[model samples]
Target: MDRLTAETKIAELTKRIERHNRLYYEEDRPEISDQEYDQLVRDLQELEAKFPDLAKEDSPTRRVGGQPLPFFEKVVHKTPMLSLGNAFSEEDLRDFDRRVRQAVGNQTVRYVGELKIDGLAVSLRYDNGVFVQGATRGDGTTGEDITQNLRTIRSIPLRLTRPVSLEVRGEAYMSKGAFERLNKEREEKGEALFANPRNSAAGSLRQLDPKIAASRQLDTFIYGIGELQGETVESHSEGLALLEELGFAVNPERRVFDNIDDVIAFIASWTEKRPSLPYEIDGMVIKVDSYAQQEELGFTAKSPRWAIAYKFPAEEAVTVLEGIEVSVGRTGAVTPTALLKPVSLAGTTVKRASLHNEDIIREKGLLIGDHVVVKKAGDIIPEIIAVLPERRTGDETPFSMPTHCPECGSELVRLEDEVALRCINPMCPALIREGMIHFVSRTAMNIDGLGEKVVAQLFNDGIIHSVADLYYLHQQRDVLLGMERMGEKSVDNLLAAIEASKQNSLERVLFGLGIRLVGAKAARVIAEHFGTMDAIMQASEEEFTQIDEIGPKMAASLVNYFAQPQAKAVIERLKAAGVNMEYKGLRVEAGEDLPFAGKTIVLTGTLSQMSRQEAEEAIARLGGKVTGSVSKKTDLVIAGEKAGSKLEKAEKLGVAVMDEAGFLQVLEGNG
Candidate 1:
């Protein structure tokens, strides 16, 4: 066929494919089977490959993803992404309606009520119809670059039907069914479970490996348009229509109401009806129907005055905690667990709830035989609500804190107001094993292919008691190779990954330490504050508390941790082994010209370039903080491919937004 004829054929195929994409993703109706869609995609790929010079950026094949990213840099949004103020009750909804009316002069308007998805928020940027980048809603101003990761999400279009440079905002969520399956997989593999669907979505999105993120099978729904370079829409509804036309998956449940009463009724209906759907809805977002009214209402420091989130009642279930039993952690923290007689909750079987500490057990007057109420706090973790003494039997035994670590028989010590007993025994075998496990965890040392079984085998063989011991394992290469299921190639790969881990950021090192109450976020804070092991050791408790999120308890823990002779020795050995315990050697993403520079960022979705750790470092290099969640304090949110609830929160907070290429441009100062 001649060039003109081929071009004509290509245009026709593109339109057909776009229609199919609309049917499958946007409409949830697949006119063709998966096999047929693949054929269409393949045909487009062949045409594009055959005519590389003529291949349009906006061709349907662009969404398939490009080469893996070297690292997600940082993106700055042209406009600040903002959040919506939330209303928990009918009265609060009325107040929101009144505020809007007062701001817009009560024109008697329509409103858009959308389900508040429990997922990460993402911003997609396209240039001339080609999917260019994706990012998380970091702080309203900046987000980690995740263009490559977003490409892996099959639902998101990589290329558009027509040439246009646009930014679209959407929610990337892990459905309830997916969350349950993921948690089940984790449980079967003896990994810690995600507390809820939101966390599952979050955890999946933040995967440093795009392949891993893709395997998690994330889904998304486009809710709003951000900065559109071409075309025009007068109302938010029109924008939604345009998105649908462009092969975007807009939420089907959205309703437009003419009055607040109708809006209230809609919210009321969804509050009960939402659970019947596949996804989880925390609330209903009420937005002014008229774009004109939205602009007039403007925004507050953290939220948009034109919009408010009316929260639905949380899914709750009441179950009796029959007794409290102590379970030992890998770190030797004896968590007192409330034993419930196997009640169904949160779509799964709930046998127990974590009591957190001996203090909580005591505070609740939790007895061994007491009938106590249990609830999933935040609809995430099962928590002991209160002890029902009235339901307690005379045979109930008074709960007492353990004097020794149950796992390794180490002495348990009490920290004031901590109600939890800590095993300060650094040499405890269980502690060592668990610490080693954490050391190789993805968010920490990130040693691939080294699982619990391998770690246990190493421990049992007296081959890997300490993290440093892992470094020397290559010396035992022959022995390692001879082990069960271990081949020469596998051993070499494991050794290579271990060797590479020595260069991870100081935050990872701190988290891998498994200090009581010190989490991944806290670890980053400490690494930034102290800069070095020596400096952290010398810091006073008062100094420690000055850092954000470091409370009195955390400060005390840090101080006590440094004071431990074993911890000091371990740090020395770790340093000797080339561990990165200071930030001096790290590279932060240089978003020097980006609007989100000197901002905080949180990444969700599989980032294309580098690992999640590397992307975070990239953000930091650009003078931004990479955080784990979205909040009012965030300045910009660079939403990536499969961004979930964090994206919504970023929008609700009225923060700035950006996609990957935009983030890179801002980082590179071209945007």
Candidate 2:
């Protein structure tokens, strides 16, 4: 065909294919058969390949996936993806309602109840009604960019019905049937199976290869709006309706209730109807319908006061405890696990449950080969709830904690004030292996391609012995390629990820060190305080204790860890491998005279000039802490437009208050 003809035809085909995609995936009404749709896509692909410049960004052909990404870029959310406080019983729901009513006074309150899909929480951003970016809600404030992967999910519209910009939050999930089919396919291919639909969905979205995510047949239910432009929404229910009109898949089961009682009833009905649905929902999310009411109710440090999640009671099943297995962790703590006869529970086949420790084993009175009741706690972890002593056979054996380390054959010792037996040998293979796994974990060094299985393989094959050894793996590219599943491309990507991790600033290295009593947050705090690894190594316990959040125990742990000769040797090796040792995050010079220094501040309502997170980061840079809620201890409250309870409380408590303009002035050092 001619260039003009091809361009016109491409546009026609693109529009037609997208309409069909929406009908089939979103509306569940397909006008064409699978083969017909595939043919349409093939025609579009051929034209697009011939006239690459004429190919539209929202073309349906993109859903087949694109070139693999080297790594996911970090995305800072405009609004934080805060988790909801949970309600397990009726009282918790009522209590939440009471709190909401108390905050709003005589104002009538309506609620929007939505099925909390058991899947990964993701944020989708659109520019002028076209899908621009999508991300995982990693740690609320930050997320990983998965735009390419998200575009492949057919239910997610590449273009909206109208031109508008917005950021929406959704649960990306795999249906039960899809999960089963995927696991069946994996089983046929001799690949490991996903534990459940939720896991399968999460794993699919995180894949660097968009083709894998596309193949998973993932779906999404857009529940909330993070940000909106060009138009306004007065209530959450209205917003959901608008989302539906804009070509987003808003769950049809959501209901608006006049009172908490009706909401409770709605939740109860869903409890029985949950399993009947193709998708899995672990709970119901109850939110104040009115946007104004939600603003009036304000938010706590972690979750909004206007919403709560009512978790369904865990599903229980009776199974035989076939055997017991124990494993050592990076911390040297030996944990016991129950090997159960395969039984189905909570939409997954259960063959293992956590025994936790010897104390838990004895407390539950568990015996190998005995019948036990197992339940998934929060529908995630499998745990033995009760043991049926009556069902125990004469051949049942009482399990005991092993005296020696399973991997290294070292004698195990119970530490003071700790229940789990520890393998004190620093050189224990299991300890080293687990530590290496921890080092390469997402929150630590974040080496992308080195998963648990790969780490274990590398360890067992004598390719790597310590976390420091990971930096040297590039030297053995040929050897890496020879290993199973590690192709030239895989080895290159893994090495690139490793090299990228080296520049991750001091906090990641500190966290990756597997220091006792040091978590991700603590690592950041320590890194910021010390400025450099050498400074941290030289810091005295008293210096560490001087920081308000660092307690004596943590201070001692830091001091002891840095004091060790082996630790120093590892640090030197890492430094030699071109790993960055200095803090690269925001840091302001220490000064008591700084306006926000040593102050506990509270931010309330919406700011016009900047996001809440931006304001918080500014305060943090100035050595001030931003907390939720208002109290006498709060040095100042930054009140924005529509400031609510926090503002009133600050006024009543005689705490100082600043408007957005004044806050901005102070941020500029002009106040």
Candidate 3:
């Protein structure tokens, strides 16, 4: 291509890459798959290399992508945390091996290979063997200090075996099991679910509350070092050993090889065994073991010269889009799933793939009989990635989302600003079953022995129809024991769990009801505000809107839900069954003499003693309004460590500033 064409392409690529970087790094929501994103970066790099004169110093390819989140304190690394170049094929790995050999004067190089975990990268610093601070890889030079959240990960050691000051790098991740359980809980609570385990882990770690992080079962694996003091480790494998000795969790599957052939073989073997692992591994990272060899290999502008990630090809299989099937979720959202011709993908039989929604089907131009490209998303969810229009026959039938609920025949409505079509009928059988499942979920009602499988079995057998029926199961103990997988001990345990759920806080009951737009947080807030189930049921939309976080939409949802006879009947049955619905959680009501009375406050950066949520709650109790962003209306800006642009903006606006100690003093009415 000519220089002008290259220049235009470079500008386009730069804009696209920056957008993707913001989505993937800052937002933790990526539009494209990692492989597709890599291809884009590769294209940009090739163009820049061909036309060096058009290349900009601030190109996305030249620097780390993320920036520190404003919620946490900023941490500057002693050594830059650089990303690695990717190797997609065997030939790519061979080329990488050739470069390493050539750069190191044709010397035999020993390499260490570790699984590339699909999770957030973090840096943990230790001072005198005591874990001091932990931070996210927000760009390479700077990060968000999340020490409190990092401490919650049981795998991360608080103190090392030796009193040595060092900085170590690792990947913080949620196991697939943990992710599934979390998602199940979220679904039950009427919350938007995370896409994958990686997203779940990243979101969990980035939470402003350490308590929230602690609730999520997060794990970590230390792979390398950033900087070390009083330590002598010559090779990558040796460094991992030292980290493991210091009580850090290290991946046991890592192998050391003298040649690239063995590394390639090891990578190949994982393709079949990948699904068996408990966590997610998107690829394999190969690094030259010797520190001396690594130094000699030098570095690229963005990646280390000694390391390359061999990304496994996303497993894809072509299958016929046999039919479109619609299912109603707990929230009554009608989701269209693609019923595909059975095919093998990623070592599993793939009979169905997610079509997502009507927009996707229309965008992909998919038809009932069209040949579609199917792939497992994160090697778990089967999804139709694309359609082969050329392979489409004239007999292919186009599909559309249903106009009415398939289960209850209720008129479906598409909410404003949402692509999903939802059924509004509260008594729909599918909705009732889903609601019953949610009511007994671990987080909602804490019914230990009653899982989704058991809930389905009970629902299918017509033994339990609603949440209230679960509470009355004691009378049907004999019938429960007659069911499959139900013994005397199990039935007794389940009944005991159901009875115990009756005494839970009103928030749990509110969440268990599966009201639209009412998640766990909202349920807690609303429950606290109303104090009783009756109060909430009788609350007007205007009263609901007066609450701290409730808006008109949520207020309307609550009013409409309570107005339903079906929901009201269930609540009556639950109440009749002796279920408690009064808010039992701690609440500090606002007082006239409170220090923060009638003040609007904004919190910036990380608070050491309390989480962002706790601070906000405290402020609210003192009759303070906590608003996002700094403005002239903001009465005070509580600045903590590494206060960012909000602090500066508050200063510019002449808003009063208070440190953590001062804020605590104000909370105690001693300021």
Candidate 4:
């Protein structure tokens, strides 16, 4: 065919194929057979190959897969993906409604109830109605770019029906059938089966290879808009409708209710009907339908006051506690786990449940060979809620907390105000193994292909000792290849991932160090504040406490950790091995001259020029602390169009106020 003819044909075929994809994946109404759809795609691919210059980026053929990415780039979300406060009972739901009504005052509060899909939360951004980027909700404010992998999901449109720009939030999930099929395939290949569909979906999206995500049959349900450009949406329900009209898969299960009672009834109906659905939903999300009402209600520090997640009661099953197994964590906190007789709960086999600590065992009166009730807390973690003392036989043995470390034979000691027995011996084999595992975890060094099993194996074989040893693995290539299941390709990939992790910012390294009282957020804050490992190491406890979030305990922990000779040695080894020791993230020193420096600010209503998150980030960049509410502590409040109760509160509190124009001027250092 001629170039012009091929181009026209490609366009025709692409549109046709995308229409069928929408029908099949989004609408659950396929007009063509599987073979027919495949033929259409094949034709488009052949035509595109013939006239490569005419091929479009949004072409349906791209869904097949693309070349693997070296790493997922970090993306700062335009709007923060805040988590919802949960409601477990009717009272909680009513409490949420009462709070919403009290804030909005005399306004008819309508709520949109949506199935909270048990999947990974992702944000999708579009430019001119074309899919531009997709990202995972990493730490809310930031995310990992997964555009290529997301494009593989058929339900996600490559282009919208209208030319508009927006960022939408969705739940990327694997259907129960797809999960079963995937697990079956993995089982046949003698691979470890996924614990549940949610894990499978998350793992699929996080894969560097787009082809892997493509094969997983992942789908999405766009629930809410994060930011809309060149248009306006008055309510959440209206925004969802707009998404549907634009060829997005808005979940059809959502309902809008005027009163909390109807919402409660709707949630009650789902309790028994949840299992009938193809996808897993751990809870129902209740959100104030009107955007104005949501603005009026405002947000708390961590979550919005306008919404709450009503979690379904955990599925419970009675199982025999066969034994109690204790394991040491990276922090040397030994936790007890209940080894239970295999029973199905929440659609997964429950072989083990968390005993938490010896205190939990005593509180529950749990004994070996005793009948206990197992439930998935929040439909995620397995835990023993109750012990059936009446069903306990005389042969049941009383379980006791071990006095010594199970792996190192060191006498375990309980720290002040702590329950878990700690193996304080830094040389303990279990602590070393667990610490190494944590060092390479996703939230830490993030060295791909080095999972818990591999870390344990390496530790057992004495191939590596400390976290520093991971940086030197390239030198032990032949040794790594000699290990079971460690082929040339796997070793090469592992080494490459390890090499890539060296370039990670200082926060990851700090978190990986497994310092006491320093979590990922705390590590980020500390790293950003100090800007370098040497600075952090040299910081006094009093100096550490000067940072807003750093308390005395954490400050002391940081000071003590850096003073350790072993810790110093490991850091030196890492530095010599080319690991980045400086904070590479965006920051501006909180100088007194900066306009909003050290000021607590709140953003209200809609800004025409920038999203709310953009304003907050700008304020933060100037060393301003952007809070969610207007209070006496608030130094200023930036009120925009339709400014609500926050503005009134700011006025009442005599807090300084600025409009959008003034806010923009201040951001430019002109106000």
The best candidate in terms of lDDT: 2
Model 2, span 1-671: residue lDDT tens: 99999999998998898899778766888999989988999999999999999988888888989999887777879888999999999999999999999888888999999999999999999999999999999878678999999999988999999998999999999999999899999999999989889999999999999999999999999999998878878899999999998999889898999999999999999999998999999999999999877866768767999999999999999999999999999999999999999999988899998888999999888888999999988887899999999886699999989999998999999988988899989888988899999999888887888999999999999999888899999899999999999887889889998998888879989999999889988999899888999999999999999987799999999999888898999999999999999998776556546678878998887788976777888888777888876777999999998887778878889999999999888778732
Stretches of candidate 4 above 4 Å error?
183-193, 586-592, 667-671
For candidate 2, the clash count comes to 0
Writing each residue's lDDT as its tens digit, candidate 3 over 44-95 gives 9899889888876446454222232224555767677989998889999999
Candidate 4 C-alpha RMSD relative to the actual structure: 2.3
Instruction: Provide TM-scores for the models.
Output: 0.64, 0.93, 0.54, 0.94
* lDDT winner, 3 or 4: 4
- What CA RMSD would you report for each candidate? 9.6, 2.6, 21.1, 2.3
**Candidate 2 CA-lDDT value:** 0.90
Tens digits of lDDT, candidate 1, 535-630: 777989898888767999888888888888878877888887777767544433333454446677766544454444556656766667766556
For each candidate, how many residue pairs have backbone atoms clashing (under 3 Å)?
58, 0, 0, 0
Candidate ranking under TM-score, highest first, comes to 4, 2, 1, 3
Which residue pairs clash within candidate 4? none
Candidate 4 at 322: error in angstroms?
1.4
- Report how far residue 411 has shifted in candidate 1, in Å: 3.5
lDDT of 2 at 356: 84
What Cα-based lDDT does every candidate model obtain? 0.73, 0.90, 0.83, 0.89
**Winner of 1 and 2 under lDDT:** 2
Scored by TM-score, the top model is 4
